[model samples]
Target: MPVAEPPAQPPTTRTTPISPSTPASPVRAAVVGTGGIVTGSHLPALRELHGRVRLVAAVDTDPARLTAFRDLAGDDVHGYGDLDEMLAAERPDLVLLGTPPALHAVQATAALRAGAWVLCEKPLCLSLAEYDAIAAAEGTEEGGTGGPYASVVFQHRYGSGAVHARELLRSGELGRPLVAHCQTTWYRDRAYYSVPWRGRWATEGGGPTMGHGIHQMDLLLHLLGDWTEVRAMAGRLVHDVESEDVSTALVQFADGTMATVVNSVLSPDEVSRIRIDCADATVELTHLYGHSNDDWAYTPAVHARDDERRTAHWRTPAADVPSSHAAQLDGFLDAMEKGVRPPGSGTEARRTLEFLAALYKSAFTGRPVGAGEIGPDDPYYHAMHGNHPDWAPKEQ
Candidate 1:
């Protein structure tokens, strides 16, 4: 048997599957790594979804942070100094990961093997090897059949505008994808990396490409479908951090369309944006971090008809929700009850990770990297630095 010319991504779009509800009550949820993201996003979301979810436990190495969170969460939410203790005692239905990049794979897999659904933040482990392990541990059943599952927090996809855009493209309203652009350029000062983990291959992973721009690029893949190849370049251009402060890549999609990807933390003014040109119109979404309905726009092709009708069609979608972890968390919980893997779970979510790996592999090797090129045996597969053994950040 021969491999297809360019591998095709599974058309695993979000679908509602009727599932047998388990345990009858709101999902027993636990959160690990009680850092800024959890306190800022997921905890609040859980609070809002109070009727459908419950917070049972919290875990972190820092007792003081845990105490602060406990006070905010009230007396009922228990804080554990050790993750295993929390897992063994609570056996939560779901575990949300807000830990650093280095700890994601081990912690996420532990939760999954113990039979809890895992929701982790971006970068999703340091390399392809870790990603494969997490992917395998997610199990076969949608809701895991009493086992475990995992999902990365590509929260932007759950917004009302994003959901609406997906609807338009799937319905053929936007037409076939042709050209696109994705940019995640923001600023991070030297003080940001003063923490031990912010800028290293073994810890922080790749800089802007892995840590920052991943969300927008994932959104690009969300809209454009799978990419076939990437011709890219990266550098530790500005910041003295161990990873690239800036990087750029040109991506080729399996759909025969292409895109320009830019991820950087050097820009004085920051913006995250994605623009897709389809047969009928050009669709765009822009914001610094997350976006609401107000941040999206559509312009119909001049040669095409339905300008006024298109305006009405675009307005048809309800723009009630903004892009945030809360939105994706709601979807994750809903999917768990339906006994199906949530959006951004298993193989479905890792397309972005694979693309992420290819981008870095291309930059490090000074050539184009294809979808099937980087594998388990490749050096880049094991570590983000790959064979660039002597590479170092300036005056760190």
Candidate 2:
């Protein structure tokens, strides 16, 4: 591939920053949903930024979970069963949503309308229509500026390895990326789908393509810039579920790069990987859930292998920062403090979501899907599944 160097920063819609007169006190934050994600990721990340973020409240429909959250978050943190009640009481500066996929749009919109910035988990919402509604709630509909914005948690795009790779690719140090592959294959037993919302189209969206592989796809789009089209196939396979258990897509990027992507919940030996073959070198990352600098490797092409200066540049090491909620949160807080939309907010987030929607549309329609093809009039705009395939179970 012989592509030009793109802009250094990711594409984003310009929005007015918060007023400089705002108080310098720690940002008051509340956690929505006391699920495993909250206890395992968001809570610890919040605690890591103690001086900058004060955990003020938590919400969960289940009383026991709420109580557990209160116990772990300390007495100062109040617990509530209702999100709206907690929002009204705490009036937090930030809201971290760890709820199920179906509730994300409603909860995030509520938080945004309440003048709170939101950090939501991946697969931000079920459809582009819901995404636009959340964007409108961010005050962009009136004047693209001011209070409240929503960002998705795409931790894989953080960390030293990904950052370095992005810089190298952007600067043409890795020479234009020609071919690539992204794999997100993990095993999930039948018990996993017993969680009610786990495999449903109305709730969890579109199987591994929407939920599991989205992280890697987002990272791929982050490094490659923009994708132009996608051709895909999906199936339920071993699992008796409303959505497919496995999916594969052939993606085309604007820079003439062609990439193969695979998302699965049936692989015996699980692994998440991304490999980019460029004119000068091949860069790869291999890890399960998260990765550190050690998980990355770079190899120069045969013709360029003898170039000492180029090889040395690729070998230089950076601080070993693992991809985690804390890493992404730190950057989000920086953007918040500066009064700008974070990396994974606004258009940047929608880009990833739209791609997934297109993948599903392609699979179900038995045709290729293009970027900017799905609009308000398109059925897929309202739901990931659109007109359900014959194989899809009917809604109850």
Candidate 3:
């Protein structure tokens, strides 16, 4: 709270600037996969970043997708069928990984070793062992300062509303966060799993808990800090997938706070929500995929003097900005240029993964799981389902 602010920085925010380059050359940027997220999000965000980033190369196994990427990226961009070939031919300053869960670690580690900052999508890796491998390649300060490293994509935490709330909690304005609720319940038809990697633990990690609700739960961890323990149950429910269609957990925080977390893909009427009950007020954010100022609400406690005053305190920036891959990509690029690890860097990303591992362990073993309970020695750490053959049906 006492940190000094940088000049010309955004209101109430801190940023580090880097040494000036020739000013003509932009940061070299490339993409590793031509999946939906990459086409729909990453490419658009990179376009938004314009002259600050130069489009370099793109990699994809599918010739049709690679041709599409080249068309969008331009004729100057090199297209490659292999990741190693692309990295070797063009040593980009930044590499965006939109590959599947199983390939993220290997791709990211290769990029980091190639001396480029890395940005990978959600569910970073399948296991902590893989996470550690990425971490080793990413050994550096946050925001790419000491050197380049891999960071996960969890952009909701970067929105103005979420950021403002974080400041309020940090300054004790909202009082200590107590009981809370987080829900990530959305519907995914059986056809969605037709893509081989969608439901299997080996390819996509766990189901809704690991893949879908992780964004909301990660925001939960960002706001409330460390969780001490978790009791949870995950079930296949109605989905024909190999992983749970729904999961629920009762979580305990280090500060004695508690929260009920629900992750699901079976809810007909879908929404992503989080309500934090602070001693002084209750702050809530409700939105489907991404959020803007309109998605946030604040309700003060009965003892509060005036609702107007609380609104004044909780007012986000006048500008409306939705949380998205573009916003996080901007932040990651800024951090990379400044020689910092960037938002969603390995450590910050690891915290969320650790919590997930704990949840999966608790659900699989039918017992309460502690924060560090599932490590290299734990079976659940390697295989999310552990040895519970009865827990899920064979992947169809």
Candidate 4:
């Protein structure tokens, strides 16, 4: 498909499935990662849900971090050094996968098989086959009875501007989307990479694209739909670790829309932005410093209709939304009650994992990777062969 310029305004928007004010019933939950993000994002979001959810237990390899959560949450909170032991005893309704990227698939599959709902952090897994396994293992039904639901963390979609943007697309106000450009640049100091798994391909997956840019990718796919092919290049240009610090990709979606994805972990300052061009108009938003709550710029494209005519156009207004992580969990709880699929089911996350796998394949073989080409029966299934991304020294 030929690539065309994005429309001068935002694409039409779509609304999320969850309701805003409906109170949720408390669901027993277990958290696995005691890392910074768990505190900065997920844990705080969970806390906000309050009576709707319970912090039954938490697990971490580090005894100190485990104790920290135990103290903050209170003494009755069960603390375990191992997830397996915790699952066996706690028997919680949910498990939060906060561990490194590589451990996500293995840990999530185990939790699902044990009949516990799962909320795994982004960049779901390192390989397509692993993603397939997670999808296959999801749900507790007859043919595949007694499994738990799984969802990947994509909180940005629940942001106010993002929700408004999606609503516009669904309302048919922006016309058809034809193009999207995404840029994700974040600064990472030596201290940041000091963690054992930060930049390693074996553990953290690839650098910024998988780690930092994953959210952007999710937003892009969520708005513009699936990609059919991708051509990308990745290299290590900063930090000292096993994965590339910068990467870029050319993406072609099934609807014939095209995109450019630029990501890096070497910037002195951070920025996340997406520019979408649609048949009706163009729209762009710049998010400086990664937080969606504030510090984001939204520019609607100028249209042929001026002043009065444009004013008559159905204007999509931005409204506040909860953290995407919380929204996802809330959706899961609702689904469990209604017996419906969650907003982001395990199958849905498989699309993102497929994109990641294709990305690595494209980067490694110096070729374009097509969607669905890496099937379950492919020899690369379960394949984990990429070299540790060079986290030190500049290279392209």
Where in model 2 is the C-alpha error above 4 Å? Answer: 1-24, 140-145, 389-396
Best TM-score goes to which candidate? 2
lDDT of 2 by residue, 175-256 (tens): 9899999999999998999999998888898789999999999999999999999999888788888888899999999999
| Candidate 4 similarity to native, TM-score | 0.84
What TM-score does each of the candidates earn?
A: 0.91, 0.92, 0.91, 0.84
Regions more than 4 Å wrong, model 1: 1-24, 142-147, 392-396
On the 0 to 100 scale, the lDDT of residue 75 in model 2 is 82
lDDT string for model 4 (5-37, tens) is 222342211112212223464777788888777
For candidate 1, list the clashing residue pairs, or say none.
142-340, 142-341, 143-339
The worst-scoring run of ten residues by lDDT in candidate 1 lies at 1-10
Error of 1 at 235 (Å): 0.9
Q: How far out, in Å, is residue 155 in model 2?
A: 0.3
lDDT, candidate 3, 123-170, per-residue tens: 889888789888887645544446677889999997788888888877
Report the poorest 10 consecutive residues by lDDT, candidate 4: 11-20
Error of 2 at 62 (Å): 0.7
Report the C-alpha lDDT of model 1 over 75-163, residue by residue, as the tens digit.
78877887777777776778899999999999998887767888898877988899889877765653444335688999888789998
